[model samples]
Target: MPAQPFTALAIGEAIRRGELDPVALTRQCLTRATDSDAVFISLTEQRALVEAEACAQRQRSGTLRGPLDGVPLAWKDLFDIAGTATTAGGKVLGKTPAERDAEAVRHTAGAGMVCIGKTNLTEIAYSGLGLNPHYGTPHHTPPPTSSEHEHESRNENEPRAPGGSSSGSAVAVAQGIVPAAIGTDTAGSLRVPAAFNGLVSYRPSQARHSRLGVTPLADSLDTIGVIASTLEDCLAIDDTMRGSAPLVRAAAVPEQSVIVLDAGCLDDPRVSRAVGDNLEACASRLKDAGFHIVRRRVASVADTLEAITRHGWLGAAEAYTEYRALLEGPDAEAMDPRVRKRLEAARQMPPDSVVSLYRLRQALKTRLREELAGATLLTPTVAHVAPLLAPLEADPEHFSEVNLATLRLSMVASLLDSPAVALPSGRDDDRQHTSLQLSGPCGEDEALLRVALGASSALTA
Candidate 1:
């Protein structure tokens, strides 16, 4: 009603229809950026202006690029923007600017999307918690900038977290400051934040989007993903970010054949409640929408999680080795200690174990396609809603327990080498939702997105 927040596609169309000026939009975006302390890390104000002007000129000439032409978006700071050095959430990456943008940024720009700035992220994009000590953590969208100043959260007693590692990107979109944002998901960086921020997001298959110039966490599982206001917006960003022009595949069947995960492994009461409630509601919607929903056991549900544990995350180990030099300095001491400790796990993991993990990953991927055909596997994006920050930060055990649960379901996609996307199911006791993950066989990015689209649409309905 009040300038509907989930309308990035309409925003793009408004620009196309000449009802909005790209330059003015960029200026407003930059103005918002100025006061978005802690929410945004870098402002591409000057560059955004240049691009916006060009888009406006093209509009005047009636040569506008495409759907997202003149639209403004932000990249998670983990991405390397052209002429902006990627700090990757660490101060050690000093004043050096990137010579070129990451492949997704370049593609998005080529499609006429303007980069407002880089959003904040977890240091080295490690934690799903989005806690960064080097660069500040990105908080969730605050109350509106109005004289009334309605406190958005309603409960002062409840602390907030935006989720990670794409924390600021989600905050940016959720706050109505950006149409969409980009972030990487080696695990659930894109999905976690989206769920926490109550926005639409998708992590397409691992290699669906190019990884060139994106700092890698796990070479095999790392993927560039998007956060937007709608499923269409997610699909559009996907199209713009691909090398071969990503296409959303049509449904193999008119309805989703789903396996409702009955795994008892989810011990967290809060997480189980959020996930269980949503699954029940979603199953009902799918049935009403003419999709077949069934409560059935998904094979390898627990085994896959066990595999990820045995793997100890090949990506984490490799990422630690990749950034070993930068993480060794005095700057490392200043980083969020939790983040530093997480990276230390990488150093301790044997390379041989990492190799073993990759083999397991490939095998599990085969299991998805070969063993489970004509069905989609559903799991909670996070075991719980975004927790109060202090407990996780102050208590190592708390952080460990939360991190394990958050990543437990997400790591399945990495282990299986399947394409997984997290969809916001519905609000629960926390007035928010646990992200629901849908994973498909290898290279089924399109199918995964379509399923996510159906789920997201149903939730809003």
Candidate 2:
């Protein structure tokens, strides 16, 4: 591997400078994707080559589309890609080929990004653990020369859980198969996988991007996002998907307030000591870089947890309603038993309770915005690093517990409809990656990204 992996923007610049060939780049990506170990459910070989060829011609003509003109990316299988089926990592759903590209797909294609393939995910994107019974789960083993290998025995290479339901997308980028991949997050799907794999993920406000042509797991909470090698790569893809001009990078505002959620208040035994330590280290870095760090309990966090305990996960209730027929239908047996069980459990949630959860979500969102008061909220993205895959695969009960715990913190941002960025904080003594999440008020996607950029730079520096 190269000392510095190519980012989407770097690839585009190389193409423009005649240092790279779009067609050749696309072919190389396609070749690598062949050995992705189930990372891709299907590859768009013909379409990608055709797009690459056109991009090459445009490059020669000096009429490139944009900064990411010749970059190659993978989409989570949930997005419609014209003739390919949007599998959503299930054998039963999306059996037929789509007739048109999804709205987000069209936007990226319009910006000249090559679509290498559709990546795998949890069935219907329902789990954060990233284990897929139908398609093999995607896992990342760090390179021997990487920091992960420095502190641990070679045994650390054991296959571990790839955070999901965006499992394949995160693995693809982490393995350098693609600079960036698009995925959906309802309850930390994108961020969890990225956190586990030591990458960056951005979950924009739900309404920030068009969800058309995308499969629905939970209508209200389902959000399209990107997982990539860098914050710049994530922001560039975000711009392309939104069909907006690139956002100008700005320096961290002087004395900008960043609220570090007090770990003591969480009182969750599942939160590892390593996660808390890494979060504090990250907070210290930001403080050294001139950001105002405030440590206190955010009332909204506690309130959201209490409300969910009282009512239940709004997304689960919504997902249950979305797939109730499939769960009850004759085809139910064909689905992943784990995913099926989860969706079916929502049946016990009374309809009135579901309604109350929705109402509570709105109230919580309002309270959260006021509490945040323009200061970004920083918390551990997941309570712990990714767990080993064997135990999770062998014990379904263990899987359920870890899955809920892994999604706990990220779910708060989802329930409140806040835009969030998950950054790789640092590796633990065991060489596992820990993640820090920074979220801002709903609809403040740009501001959140800027803060994330500053935080990322501070940590990396």
Candidate 3:
């Protein structure tokens, strides 16, 4: 039988064993990109080909670099990719190229990965829904066909948003075109799409993954996260992205205890049900395996809820700063009306209000640590599945009202500075995927990824 598609560890081993050539792998990804929805805004085909051939030569010469040598990754457009334009999904950025890839991309390069190209994103990474009239939304597809499983027919009008910012990255991995991709998160950007695509995603604790080449959304809240097919695959990529390599993520999750949050702030009934069901199932599995599973309603539930409110730091403040110049340009007519309105709200916020939001953020971070006491907290990634864009388009007021509800729990993981991972919960009656969220202390990315290992299989199965 032919080998399974790339997983970071699998690909690394294949490279070491002389069974896979980086050049061949890069070409394969480039071919896939060409036939797909044109989801990538720009392709680094020439450069990636050059790097992959070099890696192939290095392997034969017995000078193998570290793991991920010659592996391919689809970069979210916000990250500078050396020669590609860093147009965080805006018409204004044009084709002005970068001199070098972002620090995280450089780190991945150091590990021997080839950059295939830049993926599509939300307009300025503002909206949760992945609909981009600017670049193009990648189709949210289920895993490829197999004879045994019954598949749902595509509903072109029902609703399909691949979940923003990381939209193309998630779609690429889910459709089996790539093994892994990188995306940035401020307000649930990375995890949302991972859930939508039924893949695994990891959001490192703030600054845990390097931010040197990433265009700033909210510097304090910005985190570079990975979207991959599995937990172990994500871990392999995360280790390569971090500044200092960790021996293991064990210290962050300690063998001691795990807690499940009574996180009911989610507005979508389908999302709430999927999370509740999966959390119970995960808790039972952990207990049966001799892991201490604690059921606790955390005190910071209110603070977690507050993180999604309009006045929060990553919300209005960051959006306002990101678009200050663009909002004045002639092309402002091309901007999404709703996105434009949100950024405009940021301008009205008092300077003092932004400061207070940061202070509250610090307080919330401390609150989560004390509440968790070095234990892990698990919940659902979103309050609901992706809502129909028609409803938002038809009832603008309703969209504004419910956006907070969808992001409620995720914003907590971001605001509290905890490392978080979104595991797939089973699909709903509608067959839309749901994600169960697990969070760890300030820098516990690896631990969150590990704990999520066993349960993620349930999301679609």
Candidate No. with top lDDT: 2
Using Cα atoms with residue i matched to residue i, what is each candidate's TM-score against the true structure? 0.90, 0.97, 0.89
Q: Using TM-score as the measure, what is the rank order of every candidate, best first? A: 2, 1, 3
Off by over 4 Å in 1: 1-3, 141-157, 243-253, 256-270, 328-331, 350-352
With a 3 Å backbone cut-off (N, CA, C), the pairs that clash in candidate 1 are: 82-100, 82-101, 84-98, 85-97, 85-98, 381-435
Judged by whole-model lDDT over C-alpha atoms, candidate 3 comes out at 0.73
Clashes counted in candidate 2 amount to: 0
- Runs in model 3 deviating more than 4 A are 1-5, 143-159, 243-255, 263-271, 307-314, 350-352, 388-402, 444-461
lDDT of 3 by residue, 253-322 (tens): 3245465555443333545676567556766665665456666567675656654454654566876886
Candidate order by lDDT, decreasing, is 2, 1, 3
**Candidate 3 total steric clashes:** 4
Give the TM-score (vs. native) of candidate 3: 0.89
Tens digits of per-residue lDDT for model 2 on 285-385?
78988888888888888888788778888899889989999988898999999999999898899989888888888888898888878888888899888
Better of 2 and 3 by lDDT: 2
How high is the CA lDDT of each candidate model?
0.73, 0.88, 0.73
Of candidate 1, the 10-residue stretch with the lowest lDDT total is: 142-151
